[model samples]
Target: MSQLPKASLKLFPCTIGGEINYSIPEGVKMEILECRNFIVENERTARRFLKALDRNFPLEETQMSLLNKHSREQEIPLMLKALEQGNDVGILSESGCPAVGDPGALVVAMAHKKGYQVKPFTGPSSFLLALMASGLNGQQFAFHGYLPVQENEKIKSLKYLENESKAKNQTQLFMETPYRNIKFLAFILKTLNPSTFLCVASNLSCEDEYVRTMTVQDWRKTELPDIHKKPTVFLLQS
Candidate 1:
């Protein structure tokens, strides 16, 4: 009997919100050069990221596939076809680590089910960075991707999260679209209790990185930082 060949699925983490060359590790760059097939959230950014990782990268010879919110469930398995062919496949998100708060999770799950080796590389993660700087209860925390968009629904959800945090002493973390960050912060400040502590981490790992923790009352008193149209993470603890 002939032995079957094996290939690994590599999960590469890009910069959370900083210069790729400054943030990406040399090991990750070397591993990226080893794989020619990649499943990315955005092909354009992934290409740019690869190019930034190494100017000598052979982009023309690489195979790039999209796996984002618009990706269908049926199309995911096909994305892993490269792995079955004894070729290592890489996964990259628009920013930060793939699969965490990103759609790459779907393919990662499928990769595991197919018995392929799934390897994750270390890199910047906005939520984790925020949590570390939050001065909140790191031991007890939960990440709720996003809240409802509707005003009433969002307010209800905020109140619920605040109550849950107070009861469990867990830090609650979430995010919003860059463009809506200002509005979201305003809403959070207005909705959460005055005594509740809120931490806003913006432009993480970047030149303009900002991370501040304060009570809702203190935040109200101080002038808001210019987080408009910037990637940010919001954390609350009561």
Candidate 2:
């Protein structure tokens, strides 16, 4: 059999989402895999995580190169190729676990549908973290991936979510592209009632992490740090 250049995939969470970034000590020689590729947004979370693991590239590349016209057209193909090549992979996220508002969802989803073993090693998930922190409720929380992009659709969805939150007392978790987090906050302010409690779990499990629980009215006055491009998770409790 011919020997192939070794490559591996690893999924580590953003700095705010897991302990993998902070656990690596000074000099620990462990090179079981030939190559490692990390997929994450361009920000502190991703950078710090890699730094802690002491990954140097050409040594490590990002999956962003697979994006085709803002769509991950090549994600599945590349992942399949890697898996087929006998490379043990790690599919990581900028925040939370991989496949949850992260780049590796398509690949993981496909892996499952195709009868592949999809074993997962997870860290903190902002959705569950927020639910655990919020006093409103936790027994029943619905993780709504993201708000609708269209204006009218967003409005309608917000109204429905608000009512559902009120009736069920279930936490509703949502997020936006970190840069547009403020825009999503503004939308919440404009759509939800003033008294509704909103929890903005930005940079979870990190030094500058903020788990602020306040109402829409308070959010209006509170000087929130420009969490733009940061790994942010937003939650609403009515």
Candidate 3:
């Protein structure tokens, strides 16, 4: 008799901020307890999250495969092999939801191509959270991920996103390196129209969480918060 295939890979979402502040669902916890094979962005963070969920859980014995921006393409075969052998696998990211604004997306794509089922659990997502509170056009929004590193190129991209927003009434969303958040904010205030609506959601879900939407002109007048080295999401509505 042939062995039946195991259930689909579980795409688990970790906390964007402090795990203590946002609890993982009990259903996901039970799922974790039943999964031994996992593909994670960072083994250390994944293990830490699992331990936090259940202190008595044995992490050392679990089989872990690291997947990150630098992950090798060859690693996909091994992970798929584990799944083909009737073993359910878990995909995790360092923070927030996996496969969304994360490198784990590559693995998830491969799973789909190979006819593996994927199950995603509900969790905190900074992008969606910021949009929900942005008071912008959430129905029509586009996330441009990280802005260009070069100032000139970045400015050009920003201008394009701004004009596109005006033309289509779309909400333009993007992010920057935490350390460069203040600088990026400064650039936005200087480049975009003063009346443009901007939302800066920083340190989401944390005690020091800040989510403010205001006109670029108003933002320039207010005292800017210290967002250096912090996770932030930016949104604009023209």
> Model 2: per-residue lDDT, tens digit, 10-76?
4444434446545322221133122354344444555555555655633335433232125565456
The ten-residue window of minimal lDDT in model 1 covers 15-24
Ranking by TM-score: 1, 3, 2
* lDDT of every model, 2 decimals: 0.91, 0.63, 0.87
Error of 2 at 20 (Å): 4.9
**Model 3: runs farther than 4 Å from truth?**
20-23
Residue pairs with backbone atoms closer than 3 Å in model 3 (clashes): none
Tens-digit per-residue lDDT, 1-238, candidate 1: 5656778999998887688676788888789877899999999999888887878899999999999898998998889998877889999999989999989999988988988999999888999999999999999999999888888989898999999999999999998888999889988888889999999999989999999999999999999999999989999999
Q: Which of the predicted structures, 2 or 3, would earn the higher TM-score when compared with the native?
A: 3
RMSD of each: 1.3, 5.1, 1.3
The lDDT of model 3 is 0.87
Q: Candidate 3: worst 10 consecutive residues by lDDT?
A: 18-27
Model 3: per-residue lDDT, tens digit, 39-156? 9999888998888777988887789988889887778878767788788899888988899998888888888888998899888888998899889998899998998999899889
In terms of lDDT, the best-performing candidate is 1
TM-score of 1: 0.96
